[model samples]
Target: MATTTISTTNIIQMTVNDNDYNSHFEGNLLDISADPEAYYRVVLFGYITPIFFLITLAANILIVLVLSRPTMRSPTNLVLLSMAVADLLTLIFPVPWYFYMYTLGYYKFLLYPALSCNLYHVMSEILPTFFHTASIWCTLLLACQRYVYICHPTLAKVWCTNQRVTRTILAIFLLASVHQLLRIMPTIMDDNSIIMNTNNESMINNEPQKACRQVIAKWTTSIENLYFGTYFVFRIVFVHIGPCFLLVIFNVLLYNALKRAEKTRNKLLNKQQSTEQRNGSSGWNKQQQQQQQSDDHQQQRKANRGRDANSTTVMLIVVVTVFLIVEIPLAVATAIHVTENMFTVDIVSDRFLSMTIIFSNFFIIISYPLNFAIYCGMSRAFRETFQQMFLKNLFTIRLTARSSSLNPFISTATTTSTTTNTTTTTTTLSSSNTATATTLTRMKNISSASSKGHY
Candidate 1:
């Protein structure tokens, strides 16, 4: 390998370096030496991936916490919660292993039966991919539901009931789980070969050896490649490109419909207001004015809801795009490796490129905790609920646990002490009304002070 310095702008260029052609085994060497810049790129990714994972975990936990409250449940929120759960998984699982090995120096976390490695591999890879795909797909469903409700109000009134939405969400979860589960099989057992653990040490010339190596040969590689390639193509076609295009189209339609609805509502409200002003004190004018105000209120609410939906849709799109952009290269690279003699240098570059993707896994883990932040950013109601729960924790909690000293005798003793002190210091100037006023003021101050103390 030859060494060179690279700028931030050329990092992606480095990944797609098209200069050399070599076989997978011969083509590229993993080197921080060849391109010191590549090392920095990997290191930079290492730093960001963990941070993103933490953010994601915190955010998703917050979402779950907020939604778990009984009062917080709603049809839309239920869907949001599901998406958050999926996003949380995306951010939580795989990155921890990377972080553990790279940062914490704790590899060999999977020390179970060698079979467990295959299981862990399947689970570690499949679950996150499935959940993320579900999250993206769910966003599209939610957007479509909102669109129906907003644009075709009459049809929505009939078809978009809470029950229907719940069923749809359940279906999505089940389907996504199944779809993603299909990909998991490749990691477990490729073709007719099971990834078995064997302590079988070969004896060379009747001499036993302690050292043994796990073998995955060319036949297995070909089989694994076929499985990965099929899923890779499926994911690119259905999960990545399909959902992205659908979301883009859905959001565009949603935006137009919302705008048109706002215009119509404003027009009606204005017309009604003009009718009221011209009619001048008739019963009809009063009725029209009231109706216009009501219309304005409803329009404001619709506009707010539209804005929330749009924001959520956009954030979901960001999550999906980020996942795809980071992950696709690895799949493509691996798939290309299947065809032994294709572009050799590109394959080596792909192998090196695959490292960047592997390092990027932490970003997704960090995103798991972040699903709540996305919701908070996108939805006013969610933010309001979050604030009410955490920001106003004192007010939100209902407890009457006053201090032990706040009893009747304690209050009387304090009052008596104050009165005695006042008697010694003052010239008998207090009337009954004044005394009553003074006591009430003292009590008010004490209550206010107590409330402050409680908080």
Candidate 2:
């Protein structure tokens, strides 16, 4: 067997760059994740998060802009606007940093050691709790506002006016700010503090890096103890669970009120019909003279029931349902985890715990971005206005549109048709015509733009 030798030129070109690089690889390349679950988590979240962030940003912007219109200026909408603001804050403030954390901050925190103590941790600790709490409370306020509107009309007109709504929003912001400040005050220390407390203990065990590591305030341990012991439970029970229950109650009451109103309308119509029959043809003129007033009243009631009760009810219900579905899981999980951790229970596997945290985070991320879709699905005015703004090519923006028009969207023109069809002995006129007929047909998207409805 003949062994072929390499050419001198090829050998010279292939000469290895003097490399400790071979030794470096043999030592260890960085492993992003050892666990299968964590690897999957990184891939899953890292892929979809950027898309969600973009959607949330644009949707929230559109919501705010559309709600800025004069027609949308109502108490319920005001509350909804606040909720959108909170959700938008959630998406914008900490979300990008969080995405970074998911992708590389995990490793960076490990490498730098001090990165954990930086503004990133401070924000991660604060914004999620603060904005989520604010958002939940905003949702609860919207449900309550709707309850007032649907269940009590006179009181709603008086109490749930735009001024009152504005005041309530201000109050909510003040309360949320104070509550969140108090909640986060203990968890964070001033990393920017120039005066180092030599008396204070170090953040990590036998670590010299002091930059972003947790500098213990003497009270931090005590605060953490109290938080883990009592506050978390209080939060889960009263703060989280209370809102969920209240939302269901308000929505149920609104539903009942709608059913009652509908029943009342039917009873009135039946009574009117029976009275007409009893009066007979002799009394028809007098009854009809009275019928005009009755019809007017019925039409007014129908309008109120349609505009006031139905679309807004659906909107509120959807918001609350979405909130509950997305947030309740995290709330319940947090409660359980905190309780277990407080009690030093070790029944939870490490994998389970990791998955839980990831999922809870994932749920909220998925939740906040969907308000625009919900509004679009439920509110025709919103959808049409959005169409005017975004889908201008598909739908014309009417220059004459008033802010208060019921459905200023579709242009309608009835087309009359006639054609002559001749048989051997007979001539017949036959015709058929069609358009998309959006305005002439009833819109199925249960919303304010639909002109005729009762609850």
Candidate 3:
């Protein structure tokens, strides 16, 4: 049996029949045919990337489907839809390309020239940046919209318009593309290629001249470092630090607003309850009791409204938190790799270290697709559309089960209440049911109003 061993110094090398073959690593791709150990690494990625690509592609497609529905096509949903599109691009272009390179022993379409390498790097960087930046900005917009809706309901209608949201998304994409283009130029242009031979000697005759162009300069180091440093600073701000700060502030403001609303609701409920108690006098108090009950019903409606607002805030926080947790470490790692002076093939060639970084890239790509599930779990509108679009049968099954369970209880209660209740009691029961129905109808109307805008 043949054996392969990987270590810090020889992670990119393999010994076969008393001879060693080393893998040559340049910018975005690796030459692994010479190394048995390196082949294992590529094989690992080859097996896994296809799975991630398909899964993520499916998830993002589902997101688009849910967002495309006329009822779900709010400004918020539109932003999410764009995010899904960007994420799909992120996965579709980059991961498949990576898998191709890994499985085939070289990058296919991207190895045309050193210039082509730059183009591919720019593309690879741009797609990730576009999707990630768009997601963060969209989430921020949604948070602000939510803040406006809860903190200033009347002004929310005027401020958070569909036009403004569309413009914001456009601006985010344009700005991200520009920034990514500028930041990446220095890294790509610093190509310095040095040819080496099969005997580990400088060989001019047998070498592919294009692959010889590598990026190495003492000056290139400073320029590249500056470029990566700038990128790192921006990434930390835009992706991690900025979003976290906004989330904290938004949650604080939302909590305060909800607290105030809850206090008002509770006070009103207490007042209505007191009024009912004071008016209590059997038949004489029945008229007064009905009026107080109406006020209590209004108070309950307000309380429910506040609860819904809180629920939305909580959901946004969860989604943002998940995104930040998954992507920030990868950002930090890339930052270190690009900016730090200590980065060399020697440090990077440690088998464990290389594997860790390689695994991080997988998650980074996979994270884009997972956002749909996050949105579904977090957003009520998304969940409803998703259920309607895909889980309709499951919903019907659950609805039937609920109906069956409730039928016997509802019938028994109706019979008991009819037998025991007098005219006044019947009137109160009627009013209670009317209030409940009114609340449900109002909710349905709001949902329908939003639904009408989707097409």
lDDT of each: 0.57, 0.62, 0.62
What lDDT score goes with residue 328 in model 2?
72
Off by over 4 Å in 2: 1-37, 104-116, 188-212, 220-224, 227-230, 272-283, 286-294, 297-308, 346-350, 389-455
Span of 10 residues, lowest total lDDT, candidate 2: 8-17
Better of 1 and 2 by TM-score: 2
How far does residue 117 in candidate 1 sit from its true spot (Å)?
3.4
TM-score per prediction, in order, is 0.60, 0.67, 0.63
Q: How far is candidate 2 from the true structure (C-alpha RMSD, Å)?
A: 17.5
User: What is the Cα-based TM-score of model 3?
Assistant: 0.63
Top candidate on TM-score is 2
Q: Which stretches of candidate 1 lie over 4 Å from their true place?
A: 1-47, 106-116, 186-228, 281-371, 395-455
Q: For model 3, where is the 10-residue window of minimal lDDT?
A: 17-26
Question: Per-residue alpha-carbon lDDT of model 3 for 1-455, expressed as tens digits?
Answer: 12332221221232232221212212322223333355554655566777777888899888888788888767767777777787677666566555656766563221445575555555655666666676667767767777888878799788777788788889988887777666555443323232323432222464433331223333345466566666777866776567757866776676687688779777877977776666674454666668767877886797777676677666665665666666556655554554443345343534554555566666766566667767777677778778877799787889989887879688788877877777666666577866777887799999999999996
Q: How accurate is candidate 2 locally (lDDT)?
A: 0.62
